[model samples]
Target: MAGEPQPSGAPTKGGWITFPFLIATMAGLTIAAGGWTNNIIVYLINEFNIKRIDAAQIANIVNGCTALFPILGAILADSFFGSFTIISVSSLISLAGILLINLTAILDTLKPAPCENGLTVCMAPSKTQLAILYTSLALSSMGLAGTRFTLATMGADQFDNPKHQGVFFNWHFFTMYAGTLVSVVGIVYVEDNVGWGLGYGLCVAANLIGLAIFVVGKRYYRLMKPQSSPFTGLACVIVAAFRKRKVFLSSKSEDYWQETHAGGTKFVKTTPTNSFKFLNHAAIITHGDTTSDGFIKKPWNLCTLQQVEDFKTLIRIFPLWSTGILLCTPLAMQMSLVVLQALAMDRHLGPTFQISAGTMMVFVMLSTSISLAIIDRFLLPTFEKLTGTSPTPLQRIGVGHALNILSMAISAIVESKRLATARSHNLHGNTVVPMSVFWMVPQLVVVGVGEAFHFPGNVSLYYQEFPKSLKSTAAAMVAMFIGIAFYLGTAIVDFLRKTTGWLPNGINDGRMDNVYWVLTVIALINFGYYLICSWLYEYQNVEKNELSSSSPCPC
Candidate 1:
């Protein structure tokens, strides 16, 4: 009965009626987020007179925050506020941040003066200006953090069927990429070719529109009620297990606790899993652990079988989740570096047309969108038809790991060629390389293809495996790992700047190719680690249909 659409004349509260409004809001907000974040490095370099390397570092940190803060938002939504409230408040906060950023672009006093006569010695931004800029970035990142993954959970809540949820996710990511495509190509172009003020102002407008659309849909959404913190239950499991460490194992079913309904009827009739045997102590019944009415006497010393199993599920999935961090770092680094590469290359598409440096990331989005369509519409069904079985999320994630490593290798080779071209032309001291920007497209496209495979796999895996009480948190887990990876990317860049000559003030003076090669090696090692984790992992909550079919459709 889940995910069933209402009849045409029925006054239902959820289902297809909510889809248009949510998708529209997604597009508007994604455009708004990408409008500023995609060009942030360029904004820092050109507007604030920050060094290129410094700007890239700042961008990495900003990306880290944007990705990391989603977990907090997810926790709050799952524990205190529902998704709708968080989305609404976060949108307003985002609008404020965008407006402040626009003010900086409009008012000359908020930014440092432009570099004089192509000289490198330009006046730095005042402390007040830097503070304002940093605050705006923080607020914007926080706002985005609260809404991005939460929206996915909110949308999924409308559907009761797993197949419908899967379909919704596929379209959700497609909409995400499509919105980003418009921002990087359209908004970023305006920022580069027109003026920063107009570009940021457009972002402001997009934010307002997104907020308005979400607010107007209040009556139709199937809102989930907030519950007590799922994390507290997880903590209780850990504490109770440690407290009852000396308790003997119980082979008899009667010795363990099973949750019961208010009328003394058993609610769930399962025992703790054997995977994490030590934690099973938390569910073992002991003297005076429960009252006459079966209420827990010491909450921290005793936990239900379901809570113990949920905790164990987290323990099992954590290794696989850890694999994503290293896997993500190289990709993050590659993305940040590519923007810098675009700046030095000839970005002309044709006579009188030039691509903005920031717009270089558009290839990643474009290729991802195309790949998603192919995999969902053609590849998945075709594979199922031929093989009689669907690829598991782990399998999809493994393929993504291999492709990501290949992309890194390709990037190393391409960067080497670019460096060779620079040497051949005797280019140095901020001189642009004569190589075409299109040369970088292959690497970006490969990264995109890899993303299409891995990102959704991660979401599906976590959402399916996590306890139902933590649905929003489950969706946010992807953002958490990615956020950590971005932070790692920043650390790696800083380490390289301090320890190696690969990245100098001007990239042409350094060996940028060597950095790519290092990333290739790192990715290779990470892929090996990922393979082990994926092979060891067993699916805990795979849907019944997934065993036989790969199609997203319920039929």
Candidate 2:
């Protein structure tokens, strides 16, 4: 008989165990996802013969789906199946999606006929074609969502050291950004120059390779079982608190029921914090709330003080998270618009060498990859040595906000200059402007730098502070922000086109600079809001003692 599968451990046994396999898996999956998505708008336009803005909207929908599906995956991981199973299933699903897309790319019947070079009217893709295309995207989006950040939590589970966990985060994102670089620069180039069929075929290969590696390393992974839904506990906390609203507040910490020790045993707990005092009522024992041994008689009637405090932590963190949603809206719009700009501007490096517009995102990915390595290895250490303290997540995120504000300003300025050049050349209505695509790099690079600080900061913060049971959800919350931002960006673009002349059918005729300016003002206001939230918020967990930090009450 085959050897029995390895059992789950405390994950403290292995010192930085399974790092290599996990990193490889991450890198491969990144390439798979990035390669497929990097040139999605170009694929839709070229193959389906769709209009520019319409193609962007579809791409945004894909991006949104990419962001949204992870939450479902995470919830299932935390409340039912574990991460490894989810990752395995998702990888297979994603592989299937890539294969479907590749099929579409290879077969002429799956897409509309290629438009003639000078013709304006082109055939739209058939409903059957659109159906297959959407099915492929949906499968791929679900696959990407389930595997990416859930793997982050899985990787972190292998490390006992808080600092080691933090270090893992850097490499995790570095792999992510680095893989994106390879896809956009290398694979997207193939899509543009060689062929889409081969490009998506490579994506399928990458996904399969990643899945195989992860399976081979399965025995080495740290595994955890599903517990009760974190959501139900949070809901109970709210309901119990409201039901006991009229109960007299307790003066003694000992009076509250604690999860760690409930019966005759001494335990220590900080009396619930003064902020959100109304929530403290959740722990107040009303009639029939508890049994003789101080155990909860009814789950909905009473919650442990820990459950009450967990709800408070989420509520407190909401503002900070909301700022992150707004933070990416401008960037998301700018990102989509930049590709269009690249299409209109000069992309030639010399007489022979020309670049793909889709590949332009490589600059952002490159900047993020390099900057993350520098920050994680050099800058953070140097700052700590000089200042005797490492930068807090809030501080790092604030820096990101500042950088974002600056990037928006730069984008507005660059777009203004591009517009001036376009106007001088009398460019209008689908004509290319005589400007260099290089003009767009500064803004893209700055946004990348900003992400280096904020993206990891946000992930690190959520991972550290979330209730242990909700770890999967914690990592996936950042995706929620991104998904919301992309959808919001699409809405904003639609509003601009309908309400104002700023975003016309052809950006050559539209005042794209004015849209950038509007985004700049919005970013500045959001940054101010971020500053206020960051100032008021205190760190929930800064220590290596996970249990003590997460539990306001411990025995």
Candidate 3:
């Protein structure tokens, strides 16, 4: 019974848990590298004397590259190399880039000081050094793109079986968030205090560590090699369409032939057994069928034009879901602009306490990590029992969106108060707010709660909903959503500065309270949109169906 007819290519028990952890570790490292850069922008400006605009531009370039290349990586993974190989190659590439960056930094440090005071004079990097920096950033971005999609899809592969699948995804998402928590807390701090080289180097190390873990668990991994291209399916759909036309014509001819053969006898209108059989297999349409015209017609098959039309018909019936892009926008800000904004706030912990913006992220990360662990270990099971329906990943995603709305609301209010306090004290000229640095705590805590809700839920949701052939594409879309949000946020900031006469004396002028208020308002608007989207979202329970029903393998 234990070995009773199982789903196609389902992994054994051991592979399920290990796969998620491996992916989580890689994700954690990527976020850490990004996070370190975010928190240390101010330090980079102050210590290196790099212009703020130049620093911001560099960061934007890195983000843009990171977001853009994932699509290509996903394509490669889905069409050519398998996820494991992609992950392996990407890890090595990222490691090499990080090492080069470290070497550059060390070289900079070793250069002779120009001042008699013996203090190291900051100098702009030479063209060669700058080119190296850009190259390293690009390489890291490429590597991340190559691996991100595969890991998520591979993690989902662990629970291909139906029985243990119920709580399987819950654990999967929990591990991912747990990993993020570690990156935000441990890795972000390391980057902020230690310097950029060390920060990126640590990220590389984390990637290597994750790769090692995956290597050791090779036997247990439920790996899926890339399948045939979507274009192949599209070609099949075209063939099927032509065959469908032929079938219709043939059916008409058969009806006419039967009428003539009756020869004055009344023809009994009997339904064909084959037609009834086809009806019985309607639920199995996603698999496909051999058509009368020598073409295989899969359910929602993209193989022929008619099949493509059938697929469209199926899509039309799907529930109207929230715009995932809008839902993801505010959540994406937490990693990018939010970090930069937090650093702008006075982060001094007073004489007795010392905390930088990057260090403060530890609290948020720890809180989120704890929350994720609890949710997986306890909350998910309890909710399942109470609701009588295991929460679909989309439902979990909705919860995340709701949390983000609340987090943004809190951020707006707290920031408003901070701004008011600063303005009343005539401290507008001060870059750092005079209020206790602890004033930002509420915002940070709320962000933590929001993170716990959104990140894992969305990842799991995308993995579950997307077809196996498009899993990498789906994952890349998630990354793209974040990138779009970041770009939009940056654009909005720029527009506000230009139109409202905001940043009156430019970014370094330090009177940025108005900008904060504007961003807070923007956050509120995003929260409202997210709420609407969440309410409209439809949930899909991929785990309930037998794996044989939906598994990618033909066998």
| Candidate 3 lDDT, 1-555, residue by residue in tens | 011233789555444457556655555555545443444455445444554544554555566556656776666666677666777788677667656655655566522222233233456655665677667667766776666555655565566554555344444444444555566566666666666567666766776676667677666666665765564554454454444442422222122111112223223443222322222122212223535543334533323222243334224223322344455444444444444445556666556544556555556665676666667668877987899876665566566666656666666566567667666666643255555657666666766666566655555555565544444454465666666655665565566557775444223243344554554565556556655654665433336422111111000
- The C-alpha lDDT values of all candidates are 0.83, 0.81, 0.52
TM-score comparison, 2 vs 3, better candidate: 2
If both were scored by lDDT, which would come out higher, candidate 1 or candidate 3?
1
RMSD of each: 3.7, 5.0, 9.1
Q: Give the residue spans of candidate 3 off by over 4 A.
A: 1-43, 51-61, 64-69, 109-128, 155-184, 187-191, 194-200, 212-223, 231-322, 350-353, 373-399, 421-431, 455-476, 503-555
**lDDT value, residue 378 of candidate 2:** 89
Report the C-alpha lDDT of model 2 over 1-555, residue by residue, as the tens digit. 111245487333334668888989999999999998879988987888878887788788788878867888878877788888999999999999999999999999899999998786889899999999999998998899888778877787778787887678667766777788889888999989999999999999999999999999887766777666789999998898888898889978876767746355344665777879998888876678667775678988787788888888899899999998888888888778888788888999998888998988877776776777678678988998999987877787788888888888898899889888888988886677788899889898998788888876777688778876566577578888888888998999899889998777678888888888888888899999998998888878766332111111000
Error of 1 at 84 (Å): 1.2
List the candidate 1 regions with Cα displacement exceeding 4 Å: 1-11, 160-167, 264-271, 542-555
Candidate 2 error regions (>4 Å): 1-17, 161-168, 261-270, 467-472, 542-555
Q: What TM-score against the true fold does each predicted structure earn?
A: 0.93, 0.90, 0.68
Model 1, 1-555: lDDT tens digits are 123355699676767788888889999999999999999988998899998888998998888888889889888877788889999999988899999999999999999988876696889999999999999998999998888878877888988776777677667766777788899999999999999999999999999999999999988998888778879988988898899999998877677777656865264546667788999999888999888887778888887788888888888889999988888888888878988888889999898899999988888877776787788789998999999987788888888888888988888888888888888999975568999989989998998888888877777688678877666576578778888998998898899999999899788888888888888888888888888888888888867333111211000
Distance from true location, Cα of 65 in model 3, Å: 4.4
